[model samples]
Target chain A: MSEKVLMKGNEALAEAAIAAGCKHFFGYPITPQNELTAHMSKRLPKIGGTYLQAESEVAAINMVLGASAAGVRAMTSSSSPGISLKSEGLSYLAGSDLPAVIVNVQRAGPGLGGIQPSQADYWQATRAAGHGDFKLLVFAPSTVQEMVDLTGDAFALGDKYRMPAIMLSDGILGQMMEPVVMPKDSIARIPERPWAACGHGDKREHNVINSLYIEPPVLEAVIKARFEKYRLIEEKEQRCEEYLTDDADIVIVAYGASARISRSAVNAARKEGIKAGLIRPITLWPFPTKAIISRIGNAKTFLCVEMSMGQMVDDVRLIVNGKRDVRFFGRTGGMVPTPAEVLGELKKIKGGI
Target chain B: MLTIVCGHYGSGKTNFAINYALDKAKEGKRVMLADMDIVNPYFTSSEYSGILISNGVKIISPTFATTNVDVPSLPASFHSIFETNDEVVIDAGGDDVGATALGRFSKKVKEKGYEMLYVTNMYRPFTSNADDSVEMLRSIERTCGLKATAVVNNSHLKGLTNASTIIDSLEYAKDVARSAGLPLLFSVVPRSLIDQLPKDEYFYQADVYVGTIWEKGED
Candidate 1:
């Protein structure tokens, strides 16, 4: 195993991508995530990788699409508003059936809200990433180590599924530093991409990658086929971490930074003799419904904690399906909820519900 | 002493500067910390101005220091760094780009006889070796137009740091100082691990004050 070294979440993700055989990075500078881009720009050139600061987020995502279409591991990163500019490109990538990695190190949103950490982009990531019928494999990492781990997974899974994957990180996770043992830089077994549009060479048939479908049935069939992949991913890739939830009365559902706070809250609740537990979702898109459903029998109440205005609570309620009372507590617009606040909310649910 | 802290990004310079200022203040000396990092918007010393001021350390930060604004303008009171007799610590930004902001005040800083401390964490990406670390220090000096007086071996992986981590970095840090032709002033160790290591005048035991939101109170 490699020695543990301290690294910021952004730089860790960049290094993880490189270790996973990502050699192309096109991005525009944005706060909270500038370090990731800066790291790539400084390191990639020395390793003979391509790192370009595109004119804008739109240009960057399109450049990623172009590089990924050529069967290279390419990625782009941005903050909230910049991710918004990449939405059109995201939809195009989905429709074109291309594999790429997109990083959204979220800050407060709506319209250039603030630079502070925020989970407000949860809905943008999970439900409606762009104007299209598609779903991105969204991984929310709470720590710098997890950021490094999940980034490799994001690239591999995106390639395996032949669709774009989103690493939904927030400002807190992006800027904070922690001890991380980077994955060893071994030879990445890059899978053969026969369907890529890298020059035909006259030996085989030409490959065309496009999102535009002029015929209705053809587009319908393509989208339905994409949904089948989503279903398979939903069944197979649902991942989460359950903390002390085996025999608890209250189950707190959270992800990313909120999950870190919720874990502490659960611990505090247990110290007070309150039977509380936490279910932290590692994949936000898969939703980890199995973890929540399994606890529904023993858990009496479900408390959802988030850094947004209860965007993820909707999914929690949808999964609970009226089997139990699903309550939500969130602090929006760049405010983070303390463990005490979450514990208070847990106590409220324990006492009343 | 007027101390200026400069280093590559993610080298723990901000934490070192904060610890140095607070320690000076604890000795009942008037200390001031100037947050002159215009390149980075996150994790600057100005964010902890409240605690620093409460501990009796004066602060002067760039304009829109803690806000969402991304301007590079310094505060109007930045000239006070030269005006005051208080022992001042200027937390310069990372790399040559970050240190470029400090270049504007280079003449005054040199005239006042500043002890520029080049902080280094070999575990970081760019400065992972003595050669690379020395090159970075030289670049920072070129950009800031000032010479470093000493080298500070602040080598550790934040909370995961152990005695081995420090011991392992000793030679690398020494090489950095030796190659740069500067004296190894001191090495920073977490206060919790003080007993496990040998006592020395060159060891500055520091409490980890800068941390993420969840990891804050735990430290």
Candidate 2:
């Protein structure tokens, strides 16, 4: 049996990256997510891995892009404002179709928001992480154990799809501590990238990793292929957790820190003779549209709970397509809505209060 | 009996504190695990609230330690730990800033006649050598105004830790303990590596009972 270890979310993610066979880490220090960089600095060196604290988040992300092109599992992590700086690098990574892990331990945003946990970056991560006609495989982890498991999964999925994967976490998940049963003596085996830019030598012809095409039609063709890949991801990658939605009349849709609190609220509502259930989106990009569509049968109304001002609520409304009324309850600017607050929203939706 | 654990950051003070409290509770001692960390918001013993409550070990930490609030405020309820007759374990924050918070309770801790243990992961930045370790210990002592009663070897490679890592850190830890004139109480070993450890070495098995703030349920 694997022994459980009490580890903080950031430290666990750093270790998870190491366990996933990541040999290179490049990141800049930022609040709420700085522990991750510190942990990587300590652990990466012991394993003969490279841990470079880049001058800026931009420089760090570009370094990850370079490492990925060189055919190595590399990663970079930061909080909200830092992630925004990495946006251009992300677009390039997507355009170049390189696989690397990018972790965003989210904090309140809009511009140097407080260093508290918030899910305001939901749109930024899922809708358009970087400016381009591209999509990323975003994994949202609600628990510290999930932070470990999802991070490893992000690497796997990134390598499988040959694109950047965002491990979307909040300050809460990034800094909180949890008991995680690590896979004992587990070694990650990511297949060798034949197209890596490592010197071709005499083995084969030189491989190129570039996103630039001056010609309009060539760029269009390349973009078409990328969308085809995204279509497959949308079909196979939608992940979520549904709790008691089977016989629920009201369903709460939330993710990340909000979902954990929503679970508590669901349980509280159930004890009050109200049939409240929760649907937590594990992968925000693929969005879990099918899960919401399937739950419309028993659920008459849906409440979207977020730590942001109705960011994910749009997705819930879009997925439901007005079949049922979608209401939103949020606490933005680093304010975390408690179970009691969520339960009050649930009662309001059900007209029981 | 009161046992307080203090150390620098990345030194595994939280881990040693949790395990020691659990051990005392398992032995039928009324245990209270109090988190004296008001400095570092990211890591603290307060995250183990559920596990402590489940194991019948009481906890006293800042009410908003797990929240996003950066307020360096400690609640009045914290002083109750000193008033209780139960065995209390204080998990002090790392460095002088963290130790300063522990300094506030040192008078009460002294009045109660408690034991303070300074944990060290020699692999940490400043404490990589015995001299530096002793120096950091003195800094902690100066901040807390109470001397550490013992030294615990908790050295590891953060997450890439293995049996060899533990074995390698033992000598360095012993050196630190010797220089500081403290007993090398016990080296903390991950449970999985216990059987693989050298039988001659003294050690304590630590089952990780804490997780990050996001981990919210009882283990």
Candidate 3:
């Protein structure tokens, strides 16, 4: 029943948000992602939803916090610089356990590096971005369709766990135009948030939504409880996509745009009679580590391709535990390695690794 | 010296600033390209940083700030660089609202004595005529708190643009520049269509062009 339409990754994300019953959106314009804000700006009003272009990314995320606290499905988005501004809010959301969706259509960065597609923020998105020890449910989408599908899943996961969820995409995924199927009307309505700051109205005692737990023991207990929830998430929510891995000799592990590039490289390697396959992590934080580790007995080598200079390679190395030979190919600061480049690297690794 | 480029959307503002920064860096001048555009997704100067950085040009963009509820602090070195460096190029965003961020540093920039050029492409939206161009300029001036020192006419109709279209747009922008008391900086004559135009008045123009757009098959 899904209707197919050609859309950019940003537009698909906005549509998915709407379909997921997110009624509030706050964001500022930033490259590789303005289409998301623009789409929300146009459609949210018609659907009786609120859309505000906050003065800055900081204000936008805080606005999302306020909306999320009000028991409404709310979201915000940005590129690298803007996401940097929202990191504090994300930590606060994670600390407070407020369920919200944050879409980061990542662009190149160390500083305001570039607007081109980049997966450099993998560490920032997967690990604790802000000061405290907290994790965002990170979903990495390889295609525009996945961007739409995962945005809905991101909101669902956030609401289910009462935590922040991030659609960790790069500029290429955000801006590239592709065909996407709009979810059918049979999509489930999100349940009302019990922890939200909807008016108490003498129904019960006042509820406070805050990350600040002053007492050390009480804070420690809260963090321990949060970690338990993360453990549960790790057990149940580790999602990944595997292709042609049954008899493959070498496995290429990647995510987001890099996954798409790695897929092409795998296909090229297969044509040359090398048994190569791809294992793409859809959820970064609940990183399909167990699945990857399970494949290690059969796979001889693993190649980690990323847009950053070896950020995700560490994770692959950790999962493989040095049992399998691991190699890396990457391009930093907004440069996307062509499929040919990735294929050439695979050729170099075919016999050696 | 800082060379700031400002313009409407799709005016090739980023394109000019990026190539100019690269050119200066090639000339052995330490150049830095700062992208201040927070609007418009398709075009911005920050996209060229990888190439510029590899070529030894210092590229500063807004992407460095972390997402937090608080206003993220910028690097301390940025301010020091302007005081010490001989060459700097700031590529402001397309819309007037995007250009407003430059106002925060306008006083410091003026103290440092930098030149700001307003890039005008008559074929673009909101600046197709003299009145429209003037209104756009006034909005930019109000936002930045400084008047544009010069105007660079960079007219094009996307893929359909020709030399005549460029000439006509330049004429329209020239009138606006005269009335605003700003110097007509130069025209961007694409090398592909450069030979078709008369070389009399625009002979001294800097042929502002970037290599063909990076398509998938080129590499």
Candidate 4:
């Protein structure tokens, strides 16, 4: 067994990236995610990895683009507003089909949000991480250990599909400290892709990496092929955790920090004789539709809990498709709902019946 | 096993609190890792709550303690610590300013007669010498109205760290304890370096919790 070490969420994510063989890091210093940047800055040079604290989120993401194009494991991190600035580069990365990792330690926002934890970027991460007809595999880690585990996996998955893996962690997950066990052997096995923008060196035809195609038919084909890859990812990469749902009547659906809070609520509600269970989506993008749909038969009602204004609940509502009554409870503007508050929500849901 | 862990910022108080709680819980003790860190919003015990719950440890914090607000949200529930008989581990916020919140419960806490542990990393700024370390403890004790019964040696420079830093801090830990007339409870050493150090010393084999990424990879 690997000895477990205590680590903050952001630090764990950075360490896991290094473990995954990521050798280049480019990021701007932002609240909540500073630990990750600081950690990389302190350690990357010693390990012969490149760490650059870019001038802006724009420069940082573009730096990742340049490194990833050369077929190197690279990443960039920022918060909500910073992510907004990196959107153009994010779209570019997707267009070029370059593999890398992007971390968004989400804070409250529509415009410069507070420096505390918030999951308000759910829609932005899942629906439109970048402006284009593309999808990034979004992983929502609820614990520090998950942050470490999924971060390593993020690189491998990004490499597998030749696209970026978006880790949507909020401030709560970014700042908290916990005992974490790094994987025994987690160096990502990156296969050399022929499409990589590396030196041809007089061997075969020159390979090009670009997202744009001026020819209408060529662009349509490129977009169609990207969708095909996304389709496969959705089918194979969906992950979630189900707790005490075997005999549940009312099920609570949540993700990330909200899921951890809801876990406490579920345990408390069960003691109160309320058959409440929880469904925590590990992968937010490929939305665990089948998982929730399977539980709809045993559950009479579903309560969607989030730290945002009912963003993920919309995805749940779509999966339920009017089969069962779906109720929503959310707290926005950087306010995290306590476990007692979540339990109270469950109690209210119980009373409505 | 109710221990109040207090220290200056970057002193590794939160890390020590987590390791101690997990150790007690693994020993079959029902642990309560309470988060009284109402001041610093960046790092706190509330984040490890999920893993702690899995280990059968209960966590008690303010309604929105980890939420994005500067408001001191601690409620009257601070008195609930006296109600639990489990191994209660209190993770106080950094410095005297943060430890002042503990004063509200000091009366009941004193009546219960618990041990207050002052954690120190001699390598951190302003805490490298004995006088500075003792002064930090005195201020925290005055603010919380509680005397520290022991000191934990948690000194390291992270990536540049090795067994020598921890060994060197043992003398610093003893000096602070000697000045405060307290016991040198235990020195924290990374588990990997444990074999190289003398086992005769009072030590807790610590995980490399506060180190950088290059310092990671040991299982």
Candidate 5:
């Protein structure tokens, strides 16, 4: 039987990681995300797992790389600047095809922006996290429950594809306390990893995990093979949460905290006699572009609401392909656009004035 | 003059405080800059340690003693420096922890007759509206047990920042300051966009004019 428990997104993530058999966690503390490190610090030791508050984000991510190379489930987390430091390590992980989980409890930034929640990292997470010809599986969780469930999925996908999986979260999600139903024990047995480096003796060949491919052609082949795996991920793992879309004239596209606020906007719009709906992307990297395109022919307009200045709007425009008028409503630097504010934007788009 | 710069993350608080410390040092004042941000790894005032030190600004940071910079303990000397220095600037961590830490030093600061500025970037989270800004200020006050002396309206969107966005942000910040019973200290604008803004905007509100100094010199 599933039981409901009150949890923060960070705690949910830690629990989910443990449930997924993740045994190593290396991170630096940052506000709106300290709870994650705190939770792991307490829980990991109990389960005989490893948790280390690395000296810096650079050190933390490199530690994750070490743990991953050693064939174990490993994870790391930070905010914007810390995430920025981890980007280089992420690129290395992707190049080497090593599986690991990286959580960015995104805060406002181009620099040390703020500690308040911001979905500004949509571009950073969905695009290459660093300078490279590679991609990471980026997942966006809207609810605390999804934070728990998707983290498990991230580990499985990371191991299956032999690449990095990132949980793109924000301060609001990390700090907000909510009720979530923890997964049953029976549901946790799937996706066992045998490829992990727990040490193989003379029974097998030595495995050296490195991103260095000196020859250009061989590197090109490795990249091509990684792309093939990404294609499979895209095909099999495009996740989205659609709300009140049937018979709606307008659709609001958002993810994470913005999605929660957008839900309220949809409800507010419906009360005002506007048929507005919401489509929330669960996976940001394997963006549900096809799902959006499929509905574009029917919806009259689409509104992209985010905490950043039109980052995800670009993706909406790409999917709509001029099929419908696309509008944008956003708040940046950790400011949450209220439900009423989003409803106001919907009213403008729906000609309800 | 003791100045404590407080703001949310990415609000340019560190940049402003660092420059202010540098400006004071240029005037030959014995300036001590204490970085209380154990949160952000990049772009803190202490990140420019070399330049600040070379320019005769004393720098105190989490990395000052500990190899583990993420969760560094504040030194006991941090409190005494405020009493000794002619002008000391405290750059607190972002949000809750920063506010809480700054609050702990409030009595010492009050004793020293220091000025605390609550920096607000109108484009930032929880500060976009007057109500939200007021709420954040109240929370900060609750955490620190001291009210902010002034409000700094330093608003901008990273990369896509423009003059109009700054104006819109300032408009909201003006309302926030008025409601919170604090004077508007200044509005921070990028050096490139500064030319586009009307002089009147700064004439009425700003006590100081500033620019981004992160890329200015060798750190």
Candidate 6:
């Protein structure tokens, strides 16, 4: 067994990225996620990797795009508002079909929101980040161990699919410390990108990496092709964790830090014989619709718990399709909902059921 | 007893200070925990103000702590800690940048004759080795304007810390203490891992407080 060491969520993600063969990290300083950048700055130079603090989030993301186009695994991380500044670059990455990792250790948002943990960026991440039609492979990690595990997966999967992947974490998880067992062999197998802009030196035809397709029909064809890849991802990469949902009456749909709180609430409800279960969406972009659809048979009510003002509840409601009562219970503006409050919400739903 | 804890970031200084304060409070000594950590906005000792206050432990946190603000503002002056006849535990911030706040109280603390304990967790980023740990201590001492009197080996991997983990870090901790020319005070062992070790006065058994929201029951 590998030795388990305690690590904060942000630092663990940085280590996992390095282990996944990510040699280039360009990021701007932001709360909660700054530790990841700090860790990268400390560790990357010793291993002959590149760690750069770009002037702003925009520059950091473009740097990631440049490195990824050069066929190197690159990453950039920021908080909610910082992510907003990088959204245009995100669209460009998707349009160019480049592989990279983008991490958002989400803070409370709208405009210059509080620095506390919040899941308010669900809409921005899943639906529309930039001004175009593209999807980012989004992963939500509830624990520090999961943060370590998914960071490696994010790099690999993003490279495999040729798209940017976002690790949608929150401030609570970013700042919290937990024990994580690292991968036994830190070295990872980096896949070869055939269409990279890295110089071939007359070995083969020069490959061009660009997102500017001015012709409308050509752009539509390109977008449609990308959609085909996204369809495959939606089919294959929808991941979630189901706890006690096999025979549950109330299914709580949550992701990231809210899921951690919901898990405790589910246990408390189970102790009180409320038959509450939890479906934690590990991949937020794919949205884990299969997990919710399968549980709709036995689950009488679906409670969508979030740190936002019911952003993810829309997804849950759409997935449930009015078959079951979809309710939302959230505490936004940096206020975290306690397990007791969530358990109380479960009991009220149970009583109604 | 004026015990000021300082260390690198994530070195478990806050955990050690809390347990030390609680231990002294339980011993019927008047304890005052000054949460002087101004760097980190999260996971500070000020978050446990209710529990600390209820346990008869007077707590003084930085201004705007536990609020929505991230500004590192200390009190204009500290009077209660100097005035009271209580066993004081000042949890200083991490690294030299965080420890700069401690310089404000240098003269008063020096006159009071205090033991500045430099906490070291070997698993942390910068202080994983003796040289780095010693450099960190010297830098902290320079910024804080006080000399550390002893070394605290609070080395553990949070919840994954086993008896072997602590035992293996013995020489590393001793090396840190020796390199710093400070006496090795004691190694902190969590309450669960106490039985695995042979009883010795060098072990300080402590309950792991100051944890995540999910790990509430463990503390």
Query: Whose lDDT is greatest here?
Result: 1
TM-score of each: 0.97, 0.74, 0.65, 0.70, 0.63, 0.95
Show the lowest summed lDDT stretch of 10 residues, model 1 chain A. Answer: A1-10
Candidate 1: segments with Cα more than 4 A from true spot? none
lDDT of 6 by residue, A1-353 (tens): 22666688999999999989998999999887878998899899999999999999999999999999999999999999999999999999999999999999998878988788899999999998898889999999999999999999999999899999999999999999877877743569999899999988899999999999989999999999999999999999999999989999999999998898889999888888999899999998888998899999999999999998999899999999999999999999888988888989998888887
- C-alpha lDDT of candidate 6 relative to the true structure: 0.89
The stretch of ten residues in a row with the least summed lDDT in candidate 4 chain B is: B210-219
Q: How accurate locally, in lDDT, is each candidate?
A: 0.90, 0.86, 0.79, 0.83, 0.78, 0.89
DockQ of 5: 0.02
> Runs in model 3 with CA error above 4 Å?
B1-219
TM-score quality measure for candidate 1? 0.97
Between candidates 1 and 4, the one scoring higher on lDDT is 1
Candidates sorted by lDDT, best first:
1, 6, 2, 4, 3, 5
What are the per-model DockQ values?
0.53, 0.14, 0.04, 0.10, 0.02, 0.48
Candidate 1, A11-112: lDDT as tens digits: 999999999999999999998799999989988999999999999999999999999999899999999999999999999999998999999999987898
DockQ of 6: 0.48
TM-score of chain B of 4: 0.92
Q: Please give the ranking of all candidate structures by TM-score, highest first, separated by commas.
A: 1, 6, 2, 4, 3, 5
Top model by DockQ, which number?
1
Recovered fraction of real interface contacts per model: 0.46, 0.15, 0.03, 0.13, 0.00, 0.40
Clashes of each: 0, 7, 19, 2, 10, 0
Who is ahead in lDDT, 4 or 5?
Answer: 4
lDDT of 3 at A98: 93
The docking category that best describes candidate 5 is incorrect
Q: Which lDDT tens digits does candidate 3 get at residues A1-353?
A: 11234455787789889988987999998777887898799789998999999999999999999999889999999998888989889999888899999999988887887777788888898885798888889999988789988988998888999999999998877765554667853594788766677887789866789999889999999999999999999999999999999888889898988888778778778889888889999999899998798899999988899998988888889889889999999998777887888888888877675
| lDDT tens digits by residue: candidate 2, B34-113 | 88887666657887777778998988887678675657678898888878889988888877667898887778879989
